[model samples]
Target chain A: MSNPTAAMLVIGDEILSGRTRDANMYHLAGELTNNGIALSEVRVVSDDRSAIISATRTLSETYTYVFTSGGIGPTHDDITADCIAAAFGIPIDIRDDARAILTKHYADTGLELNAARLRMARIPEGAELIENPVSAAPGFILGNVFVMAGVPSVFQAMVAGVIHQLSGGRPLLSQTMRFMVGEGTIAEPLGALAADFPDLSIGSYPFQKDGVYGTNIVVRGSDGGLIDAAMIRLSNLLPEVTDDPE
Target chain B: MSNPTAAMLVIGDEILSGRTRDANMYHLAGELTNNGIALSEVRVVSDDRSAIISATRTLSETYTYVFTSGGIGPTHDDITADCIAAAFGIPIDIRDDARAILTKHYADTGLELNAARLRMARIPEGAELIENPVSAAPGFILGNVFVMAGVPSVFQAMVAGVIHQLSGGRPLLSQTMRFMVGEGTIAEPLGALAADFPDLSIGSYPFQKDGVYGTNIVVRGSDGGLIDAAMIRLSNLLPEVTDDPE
Candidate 1:
């Protein structure tokens, strides 16, 4: 079977405001890549309910799995759960299981579980809790949507908790050949080569330094042999191609 | 007057696919912040025309300025310029000004500007070209939307070229006070303080170490005096609060 398609929806105003540079996208992307699940799309929307609902609906319907990050905190802007529940046409309330977790954590820490902090316990109905080892507040999995945290460390922990349960397809293999040639010179042939290798995904990333121009041509595919074959042909087509040493 | 509100729309499938971790969002956010603009929202959509169009329309209408990155390349997936035109109900075609820039660059480099490359030259009618010094393929500004390249370096150059032209309000000045105290202890008082300072945006970011907990409380506002006053109160509230040393 082909790789399971996934997408991410990052919902936050902090991210867009330059107050926070998101690390979760990179972490999740790298994790998904290693797990053989193809992440096909990502939408970083704000805390607006309509925007979140619109994006979530579209992505959930289009991809096999949709992951969301942010807006699940204790603040008033933490409205992702409610938005997701609304998008799926389900009821959202304070779930017993989630509240228990939060209550226990707060009790152990000797802190008051105020209304604001209790906001973290509210989740969609009929959703399975994704445990947060770092913080007691749990994320949820409703149908294809996996609701994770906005904080980098918490998000990473939740991803680890859930990734093992997911079923993935063949891992995507990639080979990069960096050439000290300009993209303008390589575009035509590369396009042709990409067309020839319909199964392989060929990407040309251009970079220039001082006066020297180069392109890192990456060939990606599920089949290792097919990717290797494409790389061989690519090297033959562009003699300047050399393996990138990272 | 207060700082102008802004947002970003990152359009690319590659970014969502985990193939590319976007740098344009960070670059634009920082630039906007420095220019006294508050970036309120960000949406990273795929290459799908509908997704791009809807996101562009929504963000453009909501924010004072909307900057988009990616989907303006030579490849088949590159469709941002056309999408923007469609969103704004404007006609898009190969314009003379864009063609002139591409033609001049290709001519100077002695490279064949094929049909695919020429795709970069097509832009929406009435849009002004944003000069790209690194590559001659210009980004354009139509209404409030400033379309730019997906690549980090090129995106940086495009932002630099156009930042001076944008009308920005007073910059959002921030003062952060770091204290070796848990967020749970600070949340209530901070929330109360934030409510008092209606014009200021206050956020408490928590960090935990081995058996040690800390929070960095940031107070932001256009008025430096107001921010200072709030910070003074914050410092008094939490005696442990101290200035962050770079």
Candidate 2:
């Protein structure tokens, strides 16, 4: 059977404004890949309510799971929680459970649980809270969508809390063969070989290091034996002096 | 008036597979931001033809300009050229000018222009070629969409070539003020301030360094005077010991 597919939705104007380079998408991509959940697509939208709602709905419907980052803070622009609630047609408010979590954490830290801080207590109806070990604020899973913090550390922690709960397929296997030759020198044969084995994903990444052109051919598939066989064929096609099986 | 809005389409399986962290999106976002083009959205899709074509058409129609990266090489999975043609209903073939450029560059480097290398010459009808100074492979611009290389260096160079050609509005002006106070301590007042200035985008980025909590308040707008005025008000709201205007 095919792997369960997933998608990522990054919400924030900071990302679109180029003020913050996104770290969450890269982190989640690697996590999902290691877990064998195929991340098929990713979309980044601004802090607009309609944009967030539309993208969250589309991704949730298209994939088995959707993970969203950013806009869940206490600031004014942090509207992801509300937008997600609206998208799922559920009412959201400050839940006692969420409030209690924040209250106790703040009490331990000698901080006041003021009105602005209480914004973190707002949760969508009938959603499970994803734990945040680093900070007191919790991420929530509503339906198939997981809403997490935009901050890299908190987002990473939140993913760890729920990653083991999701059903995943076999971990994808990959093997790379590097060559000290230009991509054009091997493109034709490689393309023909790829056409022969349509099930495997064969990718060519070019690199120019120390003024020498080369390409790294990576063969990926669920079956390790199939990937191994494909790598052997690829190695035979390239020149003996240039190919370095890795 | 606001800046011209643009969207980015990243086409590749490597990014989605978690094999590669995308550098093009971050680089292009900064470039577009500096050029006064508002990057509204970014979509990352795999090497699938339908995904590429659909995203290309949608972004082209939705925004003032669309910038696509990846899938323009000579490999088997490099189907961006054909997809762009199909998206716009235009015929694609090896144009003489593009071929000549590649042929001359390869000849200078003592390389033969083989059939695989000639794939780099394919261009959609009526598209303008964007020169690649680092590599001979040319990027193209068809209608509102500018197709660029996936490689970071090459993409940056191509952007430099055409950035001056596009009409840009006033560059977005931003001023940042840092406070050594928690976000909760400032969220209420900050939210009220944001409500007053509907035209400007005010963002708060929180940080925790060396057991000291802080927030960076950034105000962005086309009008420098309005941003400055807002910053002055923000300075008065926060405590004097924590506020460090940057």
Maximum-DockQ candidate: 2
lDDT of 1 by residue, A77-127 (tens): 567999999999999888888889988998887767777778788898899
Which residue pairs show collisions in model 2? none
Against the true structure, candidate 2 reaches a TM-score of: 0.97
| lDDT of each residue in B159-202, candidate 1, tens digit only | 99999888999887888988776565666677788889988877
Q: Model 2 over residues B71-164: C-alpha lDDT tens digits?
A: 8888899999999999999999999999999889888877778888899999998999999999889999999999999988888899899889
Which sections of candidate 1 miss by over 4 Å? Answer: A1-3, A47-54, A75-77, A82-96, A103-118, A239-246, B1-3, B75-77, B86-94, B103-119, B209-211, B223-226, B239-246
- In order of appearance, the predictions have TM-scores of 0.85, 0.97
Can you write out model 2's per-residue Cα lDDT over A39-68, one digit (the tens) per residue? 999999999999999999989999999999
Superposed by TM-score, candidate 2 places the C-alpha of residue B95 at a distance from the truth, in angstroms, of 1.0
CA RMSD, predictions in order: 4.2, 2.4
Model 1 lDDT, residue B70, Cα = 85
The CAPRI-style docking tier of model 2 reads medium
Off by over 4 Å in 2: A242-246, B240-246
